[model samples]
Target chain A: MDRLLNIDRRIIFIFVLLGVAIPLLIDIHLPIKPTPTVRAVYDEIERVSIEDPDRPVLVSFSYGASTMPEMEPMTRSILHHLFSRGRKVVGICLWPEAVGLAQPIMDELAAEFGMKYGTDYAFLGYKPGAQAVVLNLGQSMAGTFPFDTAGTPVGDLPILAKVQNLKDFSFVFDFAAGDSMEFWWIPYGQEKHRFPFAGGCTAVMAPDLYPFLQSRQLVGLLGGLAGAAEYEALIGVSGSATSGMEPQSVTHVIIILFILLGNTVYFTTRRRGGKA
Target chain B: MTRDSYVFVGFLALFALVNTILVANGALSLDWDGLGVIVAAGCTLALYSFLYKDNPLFKFAEHVYVGVAAAYVFGITWYNSLYGEIIVSYFDIGEKGANGGGHNPWVLLFPTLLGLLMLTRFSRKFSWLSRISFAFVVGVGAGLTIPRYLSSFLLGQLEPSLAPLTLSWAGLNLFLVLVGVITVLIYFFFSVEHTGVVGHASRLGIWFLMVSFGASFGYTIMARLSLLIGRISFLMDDWLHLM
Candidate 1:
């Protein structure tokens, strides 16, 4: 009981390592059910595809590389959905590191879908002043980002020809790893313009967003990796997030078992009036 | 400098040599992308080396990561914000009249002066000059944010919670949400003593808060596990090509 109570931290680390690494090596196809929150994002995108096909959609990368593990899967799944639906996407980076990290994923998906840069998509890249940029975009996207990442004027881009301001977009989605969704997109952009807005955030930031969702400020939200996996399942094209869920589930079970074991050991030791 | 330092240097040299030989033998492609994967895998392993014990490799990777991040931010700020937005647009440096000539250069002067004034914080005597810029920023930020917060966050939330309750599944869910909101607010309302009905309500509020925190904590664990799965997947698929 004492040995179980005071297990070496490194031994627990090894168990966790095996828990995560082993399932990844083996092929374990876990079922991913789309939650209503995630389904709302998908349904909104579909509605935009049917209702406002010509207008471009704004996808903001409000995350950096550290969050690439969680954020990238959401970005990839959303981009895949947008491109597969023949929706024109306008990519912008609210975070500096997103210019390097997130833009490649967009470009890769664009290539996969055989979409052209100037017409099917345009990446505006990063500019400082996140909330100010959101407000500026509400006014004039062309003025805030006069030129796309490739130095082509927004005027030259066919996809962005009608997209002079935030209201021009059919739908807006922000994959945020920070408070960008809550602080910038919600009040500065979404509320001011009254656009159909959704967000994807890291799991740590997920609970805080439920209030906004409840208020209908957010049309939908993809919260963390499970959310990404659910979106992938909905699209019928499983990607990294889907593949990642198996290991994630396996490790979670291990953690739960450890918690149970720890509690049992603690109670057993304390029943005899011993220090835990 | 020390035995462990020599051992570390030796390991790095061996790693480099192996990679070079792999490239020479066409096992690793002679391209930037391929080399980048190797470097990324190296960095990932170096950082993960900390799990065993604190080591020089982890510290080396940590320093390199910080340095690279700082440099990247500096480069992006200069190129994206300073050069593109300010220098090119305000001064019309690039394709003369590229910005469509509608923006007035003089319009930027006041903000530019305030931005420059913020630099005076480095000086001891003139540090007070920065206060004017700070005050303007805070005043404008508060003025812009206050009304938006009230209307969108506070009122928007309140209106939904107050929706007329009825005998439907959605109404039941809304009722629970309304109750949760009230009790949670009551939990934070500290002026009233928790002696009577308020005590039970506050206790129920604690349960609601705990459930929310437990959900948040579960999500936090899932987020961390996802990161671990990501690195492991990268090693398995990208580095080893086993998947």
Candidate 2:
């Protein structure tokens, strides 16, 4: 029992690697249903599509590659819906590394939907300050991001011609890893820009954002891969989120089992010694 | 002066001064760009402020940053929520015009009352009054999250296991999901006694968790690696092309 407790962590690491790898190599995909949280996000998009296809939606990629596995699917699916519906999009990044992370996904989707760079969608690249940038954007989009990711001026982009501030957008969606919540929700979300908003956050951070969601501060939320999978299911597209569900499910169950086992052994051994 | 301390302080002063100038000027020229360079330099110098131990300059800068953030938040909330949504939507005083009939003056009461309740925290005698506001916030938050939590965590999680069980490729996926689910559940079964059957099941669960964790870790590593790769790609593809 002691030996099991003190086993080298490397052995555990190897076991974890196999658990995740086997699923990946086998390309296991499982059926997923859209949860209400995910459905809310989907429904919001649908509402936007039906209400106003011309209204530009602002998307802030506030996370970098480290969070891509969980966030990318949501981002991609949202983009697909927006583009397919002929809604304009304006992409911005708070994280320095997010600019690059968004490039391929945006380009691929843009190409698929025949979206003209400046006309249908634009990437604003990364700004140095986060909250300040959001505030500035709320006040004036051109001031915060004078140039698009391609170095084209916002003034030059026909799609952005009507967009002077964050209020011009019909909705805002934030895919965030950290600190962006206060920046987006408290400052821009609560005060300066009153656009409908949604968020996709890492699992560790999801619980904290629930209050905001409940208050109707956020119209919807994508909590993690689970949230992402649900979003994918809602959109009727099975992408990375769908593929990730198998491994995520497997791992979650495994963790639960181990926790049970560890507690059981400790309690049982102590009981034999009459410690209980 | 210590080498690192001197460098850091110098950079911090430089960056702050430059950025201040650039923001004021609203344009970047070769000469003006030096302001940004200086600000960057000052920030770089300030990086070593931690090494010299806590001091007034570091503390001041840190506090300034916090103050700026607070001010920014206040500004945003005033403009976006209080002004835009409440003032503009209800009162129709701002540029957007009234959303509804503008007759719901009573709607203003809810937010005002809630805000006032929050102010009670400052008074020791009335601190208990703050609970009302806190309760409202928490209650609304709870209400919102309960449904979301169920959808995001429970239904979303369980939905993937509904795959058809067959003897061929479809069955394989079902088998994986079943095994994964059972083992992972075992891993998390903290309340159980791990003696005979339970122990074996728990061990298998541990294996499953480790693998999942490992895969997650590997994915994280890959994601980070991609960032580095992206930076290199930029330097090569974008910057060097100009050179």
Candidate 3:
């Protein structure tokens, strides 16, 4: 009985491996309902009519490859919705490693939408000085980013011709991983420039933002993969996040079972040990 | 070599063989980039192997990831932020050199000079000069951030906390949050001795903290497991031809 509690951690990992793998192979479609948090973001973007290039969406890809599994799907779905709505997008990355990561998605989606590079979408790649960068961008977009990622002067882009600063945009959506959203963007971009703010973050960071959400400082919040899946459902477009739901659900159940069983056995044996 | 060492080498050979087969089966054409899929799959397996036990393969993969990340960031920072924003604006080289005249913005020199001063931190004797740049950055940051934080985090949050509690769903939730906030604040008040109702409220504060912590723990677990599911899906759908 005690030996059962002492098996190698690898044995437990094998259980999780099977738990995640089997459901993924089965390809089950779990029903998902979008909460008001997800709905708020969708409705806000939906209000932007087609060919509304003047009020672009500022998407700060403040995350990297480590968060790609979760954030990438959100990025894709959001970018698709925005571009398809004929709304222009200006993407900037605070994380340097994310600059390369954003390239493929931006290229493929731009091609998919038949969107021109400068006029429809502008990817002003990563910069340092997180708070300072956000502050400068709030003041002047071209001042902070003279050239887009491809070295084309940003002012020359027909899409960004009138877009001077963060205030030109209708909304600011930061797909944040770290303190960039709450600390930098909220202060420098939203409060100073006074634009509506929406953000998606890792599940761990979601609870931390409840205070902000409750205050209505954050208009929308996408929590995690669950959030990504919810966003995918809201759009009626089943993407990678939708495909990942069954595996995620099953794995969570498996982990809960392990925790309960492990606790039951431990307490049972400990009482027996105390008596003996 | 020892028998165990030979077995390790044999396992590596078999792993490489399997990945090669998987890549070839998945490849669309004979393009050199086809090798990329094989490398990616191999690295994924190598990193996942750490779940079983740490080994040389995991170490190699970890080292490669770190090196590549550093080099990639170095290139990105140089071209994207440093050269593009500061250098390009200062020189006006592209427009001025070609067109014989361009708008030369002198405002960019402040940042250019500050950046140069920051570089002086590398020199032992002139390390103090960097403090000017450091002080400027910090002063500007604190000056900008304090008012914003107070308004957004403090006053904004206080609005919900201080709202009247009534007999409704949202009101009940608000009442509970208000109680939690007051108790949590009371718990942190070390200046007051916890002897009476204060002690009881502080005890309730512990429960609130525990509930908050439990929810965060569950969410963290979900985040980690989702990462695992993500990799597994990639292995199944993208790497192998199984899905």
Candidate 4:
């Protein structure tokens, strides 16, 4: 018991490493059920695809490489669903670092679906100013981003020919690692235009946006890799998020066990009249 | 050379040998994409070295990351914002004629001046000039944000809680929300003494706050673990091809 209480933190780190690594080496194929929030997002996107197929969907990649693990999967899963349903996608990035990240993923998925650029999709890339950019986009997307990431004129893109502004989009989803979703998009773009909006964010940032979810300011939210896994399951595609679930679940269980052990030790020590 | 330098040299030699073997074994190609993967994996491992102990490899990787991030930001800012919005828009640098697309060339002067004024903060004597820029920014920001915030965050969130009550599960959830909101508000109300009902409500508020915090903390753990899972997946699938 004393040894357990005084175990080296490095040993615990090893446990966590093994927890993640071993599961990746051996697939667990854990079942993932879509949460209500994530389901809402899926349903909304489905509705948009069915009812307003002509209107382009706005997909904002508001995260960078650091958060790619959690966010990229969600973006991929969403894009898969959209492209498979023959929906047009317009990608934008609020974060400058995210500019490079969006194009590759969008291009790869577009290729998989045999979707042509400028017709099936367009990427506007990043522009400075968070709130100002959102407001400008509300007014005019082509004006804000005159040229797409590839230096092609937005006017030439067949997908965006009829799109004038934010209101033109049938659905908008922001996969954010930062405050761009709640801080900029919700207040500036969604509230004013009253378009259907959903969000995907780092799990840590998820709790902060629950109020927005409750208010229906956001239609649905995908929080972290778990949310991504749920989205992938709903789409019936076993992407990286699905593969990552095993490792993630194993690591979480290890962490919970450690937490329980630590608390039990501390309480027992306190009851024994010893310093915890 | 120092001991750490010797270790680094040894590590580099070992890495080269491993790479050669990988190439010879047809595990990796001598292409740009393959080279990129190797470099990325190297950097990831070097950064993760810190978990064992802070070493020169970790520092080197950390410094490289910071430098790359700073350079990327600088380059993006120059090309995207400063160059595109200012120079291109004003001087008609691109294919679009005077004033580029549709922006009023004269209307941009005020913002350009404000931006230039912001640079005055670098000068000790001229620092006061930056205040004009700051003042305008603050004024404009406040005017734009306050009403939007009131309408969206405050009223929008408040409306759901004030929805008509019923005897269903959703109504029970709404009731809990109402209780949570009122009690939490009472907890922060310092004007009233915690005598009887207020004390109980305040105590309940503390519970609600703790539960919320606990959920947040749990999500935080999940988030961190997900990142670890991601890194491990990269190493296995991309680098080692073990998956």
User: lDDT of each prediction vs. the true structure?
Assistant: 0.87, 0.66, 0.81, 0.88
Off by over 4 Å in 4: A1-3, B1-14, B97-102
iRMSD (Å), candidate 3? 2.8
* Ordered list by TM-score, greatest first: 4, 1, 3, 2
Worst 10 residues of 3 chain B by lDDT: B96-105
Question: Residues A172-265, candidate 2, lDDT per residue (tens digit)?
Answer: 8888887576444444444436678888876656655654564456778887767777877877888766766665655555556766877887
Best by DockQ: 4
Docking category of candidate 1: medium
lDDT by residue for model 2 over B132-221, one digit each (tens)?
Answer: 999987886667446544654455446556555789987896677677778778768889887798788778878877876766654444
What is every candidate's alpha-carbon RMSD to the true fold? 2.3, 13.8, 2.6, 2.0
What are the DockQ scores of the candidates, in order? 0.61, 0.02, 0.58, 0.66
For residues A1-276, write the lDDT of model 4, one tens digit per residue: 577788888999999999999988886787899999999999998999889989999998888888888998998899999999999999988898888787898999999999999999988778888888999999998778877765566877899889899999999999899998899999999989999999899998999999988888899999999999999999998988898889888888898899999999989988898886
| 10 residues in a row with least lDDT, candidate 4 chain B | B94-103
What is the Å distance of residue B83 in model 1 from its true position? Answer: 0.3
- Across A1-276, the per-residue lDDT of candidate 3 in tens digits comes to 577677788888988899889998896777999988988888878765533445778889889888888888888888888878877888898888778777679778988999888878889888898888898888878767777787777767787888889888888899887878788888677776778789989888888888877777788899888898899898788988888889888888888998888788788888888321
Which candidate number has the best TM-score?
4
Tens-place lDDT per residue, model 1, B1-243, is 987778678868877886676677766687897788789989998898787678989999999999999999998887776766666667776552346422456777798899989999999999999999999989989998998888878887899999999999999999999889899998899999986899888988999999999999999998888888888888777765667
Candidate with best lDDT: 4
Q: Candidate 4, B48: how far from true, in Å?
A: 1.0
Q: Which whole-number lDDT from 0 to 100 does residue A113 have in model 2?
A: 91
List chain B TM-scores, each candidate: 0.88, 0.68, 0.89, 0.91
Off by over 4 Å in 3: A50-54, B2-4, B23-29, B96-105
Q: Which residue pairs clash within candidate 1?
A: none
